[model samples]
Target: MKLVKHWIEKIFATITEGIVGALDVFFSSLQKWFGVGSMPYIFVLPNLLIFGVFILFPMLLNFVYAFTGGTDFFPNRRPWVGTANFTRLFECQNFLVPNSCSEDLFWRAVFNTAGYVVAQVTVMVAMSLITALILNRSIKGQAFFRSVFFYPVMLSPIVVALIWKWILQENGLLNAIILSLGFDKMPFLVDANWARFWVVIISVWALMGFYTLILLAGLQSIPADLYEAAKIDGANAWQSFSKITLPLLMPTMLVVLVLSLIRAVQVFDIVFAFTGGGPGTATLYMVQYIYNNGFASPTKQYGLSASSSLVMAGALIVLTMIQLYVRREDV
Candidate 1:
């Protein structure tokens, strides 16, 4: 028995030593290939080139252009005027009459953009999570229901916007339905407030399905054993959800929130299609303002528009960093 025990101990020590030696060699080889002395640039060259051409160059050009006062894209004879574009942006009066007491349209657009982001992000995240939770449960024809929920996401945003535009028009189907139901017609896209509200609603409707599908995948990844164990401990459904589900599902929730916030900040298409920043600039978003100034009608202010775009991009980066910090703390 002593001889057998000595042999067993020797075998275990040999295996452990072999594993440690093998791991050390593997790490050493990896360090040689990826360490400070290695040519890491060779591996990252393609990505660097792509980012430089697509992102960095454009960003540098925008920063330079923002300090100029060029109305034309080519800027035939325009000269640089440091901070003049920004000052003009702040000092410009309203295009509309009577309310033209030198209010900054750019700042107003920023406020409108902020409000829209807050409203849309809140609605989209909440609605998507609720829909995902509902679909995660066992139900009849779940596949069909899932398909129905995700169908909107598959459609192009422009197509969705056009459909919603007709539906929310003055004499549109929504009003017709209301009239049929013996109620007065609601001005969904006519009045400024109604137009803004409808934009948020339509945005939520269009995006909820996509986010729900993503959240559903997260839900499906959670272990059923955790819920079963909770149930065995005499926990109710709500208790199981709060204890086993939310904590585990938090990472997925954070991802969805970050993505939703970024998308909301950069939203443009739906605003363009639904309400062309009309009803006296009630629904004018930052992107739409940038588009109008940089490319669209009336007075072309490409330099100022570039400045606004830079500001918006900087704000998004800050917000994203804050969100990541909060998520890290929670984790």
Candidate 2:
């Protein structure tokens, strides 16, 4: 038995040595051919190729598609329309009214997305900060509670949507509880306002956990002696938090803010699977608008969708820039 084990170990060691030798020879050849200075770029070549193929190429194609007009999926078949797509998108008798626009649904989606972003991001950040603060303190079952909060983040967006949809449906758990308490069955997803309400709530519930963990990490990173020093200086809880914690945590808060903003702007899958952009297009967001135009519409307009996406991308860039500027100023 010992002889057999020794033989097995020897075989494994030989295989490992062979792999290491092969890798060393390969790298040595690369260094000889490309020079040592280019080794970093050579090492990074795979990631660059992947980025170019997947991200960079698609971004460039989107620009091409945005300038061309047609129902055709092939770029060659599509005709160049210059800025016609943008012109049509911005065409409006009155900017505020959806019915006044050439692309009424697009405008509706813009408004819906705007409202949702504001409501969702605000609530999510606030809730995450509060939850993080709570969890930062010593408590029984702290690890259990942290796990519970973070569990939703592990769920697929589709699964999160489906779970909420099941609960908010008329004959679902929520309605059952309402009836059990002798209350009327409310139309949670059937009314526009209610659909909008639950959309924000469900989104916050699904995502707040991730931000909570981030803020919790930020909280834990703060020096314990800072709080102790604050206490010695006659600082109250609020004073300690506002003076010491808030300033130190601002960087993490900014990161959370920007991430949440981008995520809220790009909200689609969860709301799509949850409400399907109805009770009369009430929950229709920008991404859903793009999806509907690009693929789901009876006559798909790839140009219009691409143009809308570029517009959305521009908004994200502007938001990111503003956050970065704020962060820079703070620094």
Which number leads on lDDT? 2
TM-score, every prediction: 0.79, 0.88
What is residue 283's positional error in candidate 1, in angstroms?
Answer: 0.9
> After superposing candidate 2, which stretches have Cα over 4 Å from the reference?
1-38, 323-331
Clashing pairs in 2: none
Angstrom error at residue 101, model 1: 8.1
Error of 1 at 297 (Å): 2.8
What would the per-residue lDDT of candidate 2 be over residues 1-73, giving only the tens digit for each residue?
9999999999999999999998998999989998999999988999999999999999999999999997899
CA lDDT for candidate 2: 0.94
For model 1, the superposed segments whose C-alpha errors exceed 4 Å read 1-51, 75-77, 90-103, 322-331
- lDDT per residue as tens, model 1, 1-331: 9999999999999999999998787667766878855546754777999999999998888877788786667644557888877666566455433145243667668778888999999999999999999999999999999999888887777888899988888899999999999999997877889988988998888888889987999899999999988888999989999988899888888888888998898889877887888777888888988898888867888888887887888889987896778578556
Model 1, residue pairs in steric clash:
none
